[model samples]
Target: MNIRITLDGKEIETTAGTLLVDVAADNGVYIPTLCYQRGKPCLGTCRACSVRVNGNVMASCTVPVAEGMTVEVDAADLNDMRKALVELLFAEGNHNCPSCEKSGRCELQAVGYEVGMLVSRFPYRFPPRTREHVAKYIWLERDRCIFCQRCVEFVRDHETGRKIFTIDDRGTHASIEIDVALADRMPPEQVREAAELCPVGCIIAKGVGYDKPIGQRKFEVKSIRERTLERSRK
Candidate 1:
């Protein structure tokens, strides 16, 4: 089935069931996404890849290409909306990129720069940090969590063949929680992988400190589109 959609004033036709992200990428339209990787599962929890579809803001990762769909990739309102979302994430977490390890190479930082968010308008919540050292090889910093559930999704559904992570609260207090029973027995490698999958420095490798300098990180090499395309090709 062929589906035709208008993106940023250009008409593009693609096969049905194609993701909006792939469609936009193929058409050279960039949408910043953190929880989405090319070869990975689509966890629509991150609102970063959102776009205006016929005047409605929605997550492009979850939206399948539809015939006659009018998609606006860079509409000013959408951009502002995404920027505000980024700002909220920053205010909620302990990003402090200047002192963190993933600073220059962090996806959250790169997305902030892409959307031109120099400072957050929302007052910082500065939530209390929870440090869990169950793995010893890795430390889980709950403060940096955006509650994207990428780690939970990857660990339980993708790698472990079981659901070990889940949201433990509701509304603004929702958070990613690991099943303590399973988390105690989970392998260090799996924990480390989950930590690495984090777009922000919420989960940090214990001994592996920042290896790259500020100016030489991968995020500095290309725009988010180029990076996403490169990952897709891999």
Candidate 2:
């Protein structure tokens, strides 16, 4: 069954129970996502995909499509809010993009560019954090983590289904933890998967850095919007 909803004043027809993010994307509307991976359970952890539906703000990935719903994805106020959200993330963490290895390929950085964030309105936290290089294949630079929870929810031990990355503490003091036993046993592919799953440079694969170079990185060649919209076109 299909449902019709008005997105940014354009009527979009999509399957019932389809996430608003997917519905918008299928119709060429890009909702920025930081913690969403297609086919995975919606975590709603990042809240980067927040959009107005029926005059109320909600995470697009967590909202299901319904008939006659009015969504405001391109509204100016929402865009401002989105930019502020990006800036907050920048200010919250120690994201020194210039010196970070994930500078160009980082989704958080790309989203910052997408939202036209020149500077953060809020003061930078610059919270003290510790780095861990316990695993032979991977390292954790805790300073740059945005607490997106991707590694905690997605990456797991293949044999025991135990989480390799778990959250420690709560709220502002919360930190990412690794199950050393499981992390050490991770296969090479899983090692790569964990590194790639992180949206920032917090999760570093030990041996490689600056592999793609400055100009030839993921978002350096094309904007995140262009990359995503092109995928929808195909």
Candidate 3:
């Protein structure tokens, strides 16, 4: 069954139970996503896809389409809220964009550009976090992690189907933890997949940095919005 919902003042007819984010994207609307991956269970950790649903703020990636639903994806206030969320991530994390290996390819950096974030309004935490290269194939740069939970939910041990990445502690002391044994057992392709799954440079693959030169990176070839919308069409 198909349901009609109003998105950014345009009525769109989409399959019932389809996520609002996908519905909007199918209709050529771009809603920035940080932790949400298409066809996967909603983690709802980043909340970058938050939009007004029936005049209330909700995570679009988690919300299913409903009849008569009114979604405000492009509203000015909503854009400002999204922009602030990006800024908060920047202020909370030590994201040295220019120096980071994921510079041009980082989704956070691309989204920052899309949101027109010149500088964070909030004070930078600059919390002391050490880089971890203990794993045989992975580099753990804790400072750049935004707690997106993508690695925790998506990347897993193929044989055991168990989580290879997880979070430690809660709130301010929270940090991402990896099962070194499971991580080491991961195939080379899977190892690269884990690093690619990361939105930031946090989960870098050891011995793989600056492989793609300037203008050849993921987001560099085309803007995130363009790439996302283009993907939606295919």
Q: What is the C-alpha lDDT of each candidate?
A: 0.78, 0.89, 0.91
Candidates 2 and 3 compared by lDDT, better number: 3
**Worst lDDT window (10 residues) for model 1?**
131-140
Q: Number of clashing residue pairs in every model?
A: 0, 0, 0
True-vs-predicted CA distance for residue 30, candidate 1, Å: 0.4
lDDT of residue 32 for candidate 2: 88
* Segments in model 1 whose C-alpha atoms lie over 4 Å from true places: 157-160, 179-192, 232-234
* lDDT by residue for model 2 (45-93), tens: 9888999999999999999898899999898999989889889999998
Q: What would the TM-score be for candidate 1 when compared with the true structure?
A: 0.88
RMSD of each: 2.4, 1.0, 0.8
**Which of candidates 1 and 2 reaches a greater lDDT?**
2
Write one digit per residue (lDDT tens) for candidate 3, span 169-223. Answer: 9888999998999999999999989898899999999998889889888888999
lDDT of 1 at 3: 77
Query: How far is 92's C-alpha from truth in model 1 (Å)?
Result: 1.5
**Clash pairs (backbone) in predicted model 1:** none
Kindly report which residue stretches of model 3 are placed more than 4 angstroms away from their true locations once superposed.
none
- Please report how far candidate 2 places residue 4 from its true position, in Å: 0.8
Q: How many backbone clashes does candidate 2 have?
A: 0
